[model samples]
Target: MALAGVRVVELAGLAPVPFCGMILADFGAKVIRVDRTKVTMAMDTQARGKRSLALNLKTPEGVSVLRKLCVQSDVVLEPYRKGVMEKLGLGPEELLKENPRLIYARLTGYGQSGSYAAAAGHDINYLAMSGLLSMLGRRGEKPYAPLNLVADFAGGGLTCALGVVMALLERSQSGRGQVIDTSMVEGAAYVGSFMWKSRSIGMWNNPRGENMLDSGAPFYDTYQTSDRKYMAVGAIEPQFYSQLLHGLGLDDADLPSQMSFSDWPKLRQVFTDCFATKTQAEWRAVFDGTDACVTPVLSLEEVSSHPHNQQRESFLQDSQGEESPRPAPVLSRTPAQPCQGRDPFIGEHTRAVLEEYGYQPQDIDRMLSTGVLECNAAKARL
Candidate 1:
C-alpha cells in the first residue's frame, strides 16, 4: 500500500483510466471515480476498487462537483482527448490553481501536443505507429494484435499511473504540481526500446515475425503438440539450447545448428516434427525442472486454477466467483491485497462520499435535487 491516505479522483471513460484507478486503489488510495451517469458496471473492470460518483458533465453543476473533488484530491487521472477536460472546466490549469501539489495526469491515444492528438485511434493503431505491431506473429503472416494489453494497459494505463507516482514523489520536495501528458503511441514506443536500439544498428527489419524474438529462432518460439495444445520455448543461450536439444533426445549432428539462418527453416521443420510426437503435458514432464526454459501455454481458465497461482493467492475473489487478475510484485512489508468490492454501480457512493467530505445533510439533499450528484441505491450490477 504505497499510496495510503492519499485521495485520487479519476475522471474516467474506458480502459486505462479504470486501470490507473485500480492500481491506486490496490495500494490503499481513496480512489473516487467520477463516471458517466449512463455507463454500466458490467463493462468496466477499471472501475473496480473505487467508490463511484456519477456526474452528468453536460451540466455545469457536474463540472463544479468534480472541481471541488479535485481541490481535495492528491491526484487526478483523466484519459480523454486533448481538449475534452479543458472543455469540462476541470483542466489541469484550473485544478492545479486550486491545489498546487496535485498530480494531474492526462492519458490519450496520441499525446497532448501531437498533430494527431485529437484523432480517433485505439490500441492497434498506437502499436502500429510504434513499429511493434510489425514484429509480432509467425513468419510470412500478418501481424497479430496482442489483444489490447500493450497500448491500453502497459503503455497507457500503467505508464500514466507510474507518471502520477513519479510526479507525486517530486511534488513532496517542490510542493509544486505539474501536468503529465502521456501518449499511448509514445508509451508503446518507449516499451519497444530494444527495437529502437536494433534499428539504430541496422539489426531491425519491418517484415512481420522475421526477427529473433518474433519467431525467427526455432528454439525461441511456440510449438503445437499432438493434443493441439501449445508450449513456449526459450532456450536462448547456446548451453540452454543444447540442453533443449538433449532433452528432446535429438542428436546435435543430425539437427541444423543455431545461428545458421539459411538452415533455420529446415531446423524448424525437424523441431516441429519432433514436438508433434508428444502432448503439451508430456513435453512439460520432460522439461519440468530443466534450465531449457520451456513452459506450457496455459489458457486463461487454466491460469485461474493453476496450482502456483493458487498457492500464492495471485487471483483474488469478489462476491462473484470471478477474481482480480493477478496480484502485483511482492513487497517485503505492507503487501497489497484485494478489495472486497467489484466495480461500483454508477454513483453508488455519491451521498456517502458527500457526507464524508463534510457536506451537510441539507446541502447534500439540495445538491442531489439540483442535479449536482446522482446515486444508485440498488447493489452494483455484476
Candidate 2:
C-alpha cells in the first residue's frame, strides 16, 4: 500500500480519469470513484482497486455526498469540460474552501482558459493543435491518430498525476491547496518541445515522415524481412552504422556514403535490397548483443512472452484472470502488487463507503430512497 491511508477522490470518465485512479491505487491510496449507475466492461478494468459509489449528481443528495468527500480527501481528480464540475457543485474553488490541503487536479482537452477552452475536442484535435500531426505518416498520406496514447495518457493523465504530486508536496509546507490546470493540448505541446526547438534552428522539417527521426535516415527506420516481419534499427552513430554495415558483410565499395544527405535515397535502396534477402530472425541473429543497435519489431502478443520481458516480469496476471500491465520501476522495498479485485460495479460499495465516511446506515438508506444517492439500477426503482 504505497499510498496507504491517503484518501483520493475521482470524478470518473474516460482514459485519463481511470488511469489516474489506477496509479493512485497501485501506490496504496484509498481512491473512491464516483461513477454513474451504468457500468461498462472497459470502465470496470480501469476502475479496479477503487471503491465505487453511484450518486445521480442530478439530485441534490448526490451533490451533497460529493461535497462531503471533497472535505475529507487529500486530492481530487476531475476530467470534464471546464464548467462541468462547477455545474455539479464540485468545482476547484468550492472544493479548495472545504479542504485547504487538497490537491485539485483538473484535466480537460483544451484547458481552464483559452480561446478553445470551451470548444469540444479530443486526442486527435490536440495532436493537430500541437503541430504533432504535421510529422506523422508518410510524405503523401494523411496524418493518422497516434492512437490516444499521446494526448490521453502522456499529456493528460501523467501530467495531471505529476502536477498533483507536486502540489501535494507544496501543500505540506504551505498548508494550502492549489488548482492544477492540465490541458491535453498544452501538455502535448510541451512534449513536442524538442521538435519545436529543432524546427526553429532549421534542423527539423515539418513535412510528414521526411525528417531524420521519421523515415529520413536509413539507419533509424523500420525494414521488412523476407517473411514480411519488420525490424527496427537505430544505429545512429558513425561507428554504430559502420558496425551494422560491417556485421551484415556488405562490401565497402558497394556501401552508400554516410554523410551525404542527398545520397540517402540511393543508400536506402541498397539497405532495402540487402535486408530483403534475410528474414527478421536471421537479422536478429546477426545483430544480437552487437553495437549495431538493432532489434525486431515485436507485436503485443509476442512482447509479453519475449525472454527479456518474461525475465523482468513486466506483465502479470491478476486474481481476476486479466493480464494487466504491471507496476513499473521496481522499488527496492514496498513493491506495488497486481490489483486483485474486479472493477467494482457502479455503487457496488456505496453503503460501505458511506459508512467509512461517517454516515449512519439509516441516513445512507434515506439518501438512497430520496434519490440523493443510488447504488445499482434496481435501487433506482424503489
| Candidate 1 per-residue lDDT over residues 125-209, each given as its tens digit | 9999877887877778888878998999899998998998889899888998899988899898898888878887755553656
**Candidate 1 residue 322 C-alpha distance from true site, Å:** 0.7
Which segments of model 2 are wrong by more than 4 Å?
Answer: 38-44, 376-382
Top-lDDT structure, candidate number: 1
Please provide TM-scores, in order, for all candidate models, with all chains considered together.
Answer: 0.95, 0.92
lDDT of each: 0.82, 0.80
Which candidate number would show the highest TM-score if scored against the true structure? 1
Q: How does candidate 1 score on lDDT?
A: 0.82
Clashing pairs in 2: 3-27, 3-28
Runs in model 1 lying further than 4 Å from the true structure: 39-42, 200-206, 379-382
- Write down the lDDT that model 2 would get: 0.80
As a TM-score, model 1 comes out at 0.95
